[model samples]
Target chain A: MPNSETMAGTSAAHSEAMIGLYDVHKSFGPLEVLKGISFEVPRGGVVALIGPSGSGKSTILRCVNLLETPNAGTIKVGAQTLAFSKRHRLPGDRRLADFRARTGMVFQSFNLFPHKSVIENVMAGPLIVKRMARDEARAIAERLLARVGLAEKAEAAPARLSGGQRQRVAIARAMAMEPDVMLFDEPTSALDPELVAEVLAVIRGLADDNMTMLLATHEMAFARDVADRVVFMRDGVVVEDGPARQVIETPQHPATQAFLAHFHRR
Target chain B: MSGVSYHWDFSFLWGYRTVLLTGLAYTMAYTVGTILLGLVIGLVAGLMRMSRNPFIRGPAFAYIEIFRCTPLLVQIVWFYYAFPILIGIEMSATTAAVLVLSLYTGSFYAEIFRGGILSLELGQWDAARAVGMRQGQLMRHIILPQAVRRMMPPFINQSVIQLKNTSLVSTIAVTDLLYQGMLITAATYRPLEVYTLIAAIYFVVLFPLTALGQYVENRLRYAE
Candidate 1:
């Protein structure tokens, strides 16, 4: 019950939500990406959202940051509800840039700026978004890179790093933003099986530090191992949500059990 | 006699070396200036063509299409002569050359820049967005820098073309290198020797640029 209480408390914090979505809908011509997607993430907790491919998990994550405009919805991040629609006429809002300043994301493909060294990539957020002094950002970037065990590779271009190392650098880039919460969009899904362990380890370290996180991933084992709560999604709706152990072990919903059965085998 | 005599005097080019040298400087200055301006306009226009809003998107696409369909020489002349006639504004031959050259090169540069940025793995855009970046941030931070590595060759190539197009400015009396060469040929009786010297100077200037382009292509490929 305390777990549900925690979730409710997390949801209640939506009065000035760190991130919130309500009745969001998105369509690309005839292809619908989000169908009334609604959820909220509070200040500090790890919420793992699992769903089938094309279930709009990534879209939902993107909409939170206004990367993808939803056709109809209200998204609030930290007392500010972003306006997103197919036809709204506001352009070049620098405040939106500032809002994203306090939020960061680790991507599935480790989108490190290929031209920049690992440290430069890490420094990009603070330098560009936060307007931190270059030298200061560089110093802190090295520390963040070190935190992810990439200190030696600070001067290395991301192309020179291995898949896992690049993803860790991507994580460091996000962390350097000093965000309130970090969003991860399948951060390890692109890695080789062996490399996944290293990425998962860096992520585990972030969890250990009690950083608030929202991850959309299919790594059920990872969900069970690190996630505080698991949300099973189907057809763009949350089907079942509970503690990782219970949800993965004795899923009540038919969809959840079926999903776990497939997940357990592999 | 034509083969043996060569009907050429080299003295004219040597005497007018100052004219040729000044023309060369203007050529390079014109090329470098337009290439940078063209690249900036192309970068913005290319992204605008991809914009989400139709109002923002349509004009960029239309502008690029119209310019791309028109010949550079015609555009140059149009800007040089017709522009003043149509718009009641007069620009000098040099100014007109630079303005038309930038617009002409910008349309082609837009294609190269857009293609380079687009060639990036689709996941790059997704990754940028997931970090809470707007399209501008995504372009400036993620896409532009990465695209640049692939873009250097074509961008440099456009500059080279801009350099070559400087010859076209001679028609408008801009006194570019090619025009100066022609002027020397007219004043001097030795067409063979004067034209040969001009060709050598042009080769001297262009060969290094072409080599640099090749070097850049190799470096970017190796980085990948």
Candidate 2:
């Protein structure tokens, strides 16, 4: 077991947590959002962050990439660790860019570069940030598009795609970056009810591949089925963290129960 | 004919062909030069206007505000007359016209650039940053492509307006189309015919440009 631990450490994102957030605090002027929140996602772990609206779930997801710099906290992603003090400046531009390259994010609205074709959106990160060769980047993009079942849409614009298709393309775009960890901020929340299944299926496939992921989502049933662990947060604090099945079936906190009740009404 | 002239003469224009042609070319050259230089200034000013640093943003704000509030005609006259006097360095009429028009057009374009950028949803910025794109890459790849599409129609409209405004340079005796036309009218003592010909030339030039503007607008139209 000791030998295995060292072996795992050598492999990229093997046993150690790929992401860690400790005592993270965030505020927007007069309003406070995340208050001393802490969590960890082990290599290949799928952690689902479920919470009510304005519960700081999305804010937490944003902080992982420094899109919304935390008011205070320590964050670690992959092998890089960032510590924040009361007056800590944001990481230097070069450092932040490097941190971002290691992490991929999908958004609720897809945010696919609307002007670019489907293949271009997926290839953009590798081509621009990674400075990948055109042919090499194109091949990677083609592979990812095929994986998402959007190979035919490679030449299509994001505006022409349906909601489900757009989100799938967004997923493919993120995956093309070969990030060590992926973040989904309500990836399916913006999709229509009938269209939600397609996006969920892509995410499920990602889970099966053992890709480390942190998702802020409202798909309770999917979370129960796919997540290794569930983190229930409300009012900027974790209410319960446990196995997905246990948390969904038998939540310990009243707030979690109340929140779950709203979802279960359907 | 409708107002006073019972007869219109086309013979006068034949003698002044070279003067008119030269003026037209000068007008076009000045317009193109102003557009290129103005766009550069606008892009830099627009980014500065959005900067978080007050030092950069303040001067940019002042430039946009001052130029926008004053009339283009007044700015041209002031630059032509006062700039050299104040700086103690003389500039030709053509040089002053180009400088004034470039700055004036740039002020309008700064607003166009700023608005196009601000109109993008915050989600796009967040998504781009999440992918770890640097500020420059984000703008070149994500922000500008989308923003430029929105900018094109207005930009075309501005181009048309600026082209017409190029005639203002004639007032400073730059020997542009309108100025040449004025000289022809004074010499011929046939103001009606000369002015009518000038109007026709402007219409002929501007009509095609307006059509091209519309074509660009339709081509770049984004799907909802």
TM-score of chain B of each: 0.93, 0.94
| Global local distance difference test of model 2 | 0.88
CA RMSD for every model?
3.7, 4.6
TM-score of chain A of each: 0.90, 0.93
Q: Write the per-residue lDDT of candidate 2 for residues A18-80, one digit (tens) a residue.
A: 988877899999889998787788889999999989999989988988888898887889998
Q: Using Cα atoms with residue i matched to residue i, what is each candidate's TM-score against the true structure?
A: 0.87, 0.93
- Reference contact recovery of candidate 2: 0.76
lDDT of 1 by residue, B1-224 (tens): 66985554565566787988988888888888888889888988888887888998999899899889998889888898999989898789988998888888888888888889888988777666554566677788888887878889988887777788778888888887888888887886666776788778888988899999999999877767
- Using lDDT as the measure, which candidate wins? 2
Clashing pairs in 1: B8-B190, B9-B190
Please identify model 1 stretches exceeding 4 Å from their true place: A1-13, A16-18, A83-92, B1-13, B122-138
- Model 2 clashing residue pairs (backbone): none
